[model samples]
Target: MPRVTFIEPNGTEHPVEIANGYSVMEGALNNSIRGIDGDCGGNCACGTCHVYVAAEWRERTGRQSEMEHDMLEFAEGVREDSRLCCQIEMSDTLDGLVVHIADSQH
Candidate 1:
């Protein structure tokens, strides 16, 4: 399982252990993690699952798809580290992943 951590705007944290192979968006939506809306499910069409990958985890998470990149341009509260949670593939390497929900989704 991959240990996922969701940080709230006020610094509250929600952590869950999810099976590998699912996207980070799925983990948050399924677990009711209270941040990610995943309005378009795991698809990259919606920017509702927007999140910020911890600065240090940026390289480990790799690059976003072209479509995801374009969609994120429409995401609210975007930052240099912003990424769509749906684009993140779950894996043991992401066990300690830290993400913050988009302000729009919250």
Candidate 2:
């Protein structure tokens, strides 16, 4: 299993232990984590699952899809670290990834 930690804007830490192969959004949803609305249910058609990857983990997470990059352009708080949780697939490489949910989604 992998773990996805959401560092809320208010500085709260919400850690969710996720099973292999599930997206970070699935992890958040299953754990009842707040701040990740996942409005489009991981379809990559919505920006509601937008989050900022921790600077240290960005490289390991790899590149974002064109769709994600384009959708992020419309996100309220897009940043260099912005990523759609639905597009972030879980794997051993992302076992301990930490993502910060933008304040706008809170």
Candidate 3:
């Protein structure tokens, strides 16, 4: 399992242990972390799960796919680190991953 920390706009942090192969959106939803709507059920169809990957962990989280990039265009506060949580699958190497939930997701 890997640990992920989701930071809210107000500076609150919700950290949880997530199983390998699960999506970041799943980790947030399962832990009852606020801000990530995951409305499309981790299918990348919705941009409600938008998050900003911390600079240190961005490389580990990897780049977004073409479809994901297109979807993120509709997300609020889009940035270089912005990513759809549904598209970020958890893995051992991503332990201690930290992401900031977008203000719009609230």
> Which has the greatest lDDT?
3
Residue 11, candidate 3: alpha-carbon lDDT: 94
List the candidates ranked by TM-score, beginning with the highest. 3, 1, 2
Residue-by-residue lDDT tens digits, candidate 2, 34-102: 888898999998899889987888878878989889888889988888999998888988877889889
TM-score per candidate: 0.94, 0.94, 0.97
Quantify all predictions' global Cα lDDT against the true fold.
0.87, 0.87, 0.92
> In candidate 1, what residue range of length 10 has the lowest lDDT sum?
34-43
- What's model 2's TM-score? 0.94
| Candidate 1 error regions (>4 Å) | none
Clash pairs (backbone) in predicted model 2? none
Q: Which ranges in model 2 have alpha carbons more than 4 Å from their true place?
A: none
lDDT of 1 by residue, 1-106 (tens): 7899998887789998878999988998889987788888787988988898878998888888799889998888888889999999899998899998767776
In model 3, pairs of residues that clash are: none
Worst 10 residues of 3 by lDDT: 53-62
**Model 1, residue 7: displacement in angstroms?**
0.4
Instruction: Choose 1 or 3, whichever is better by TM-score.
Output: 3
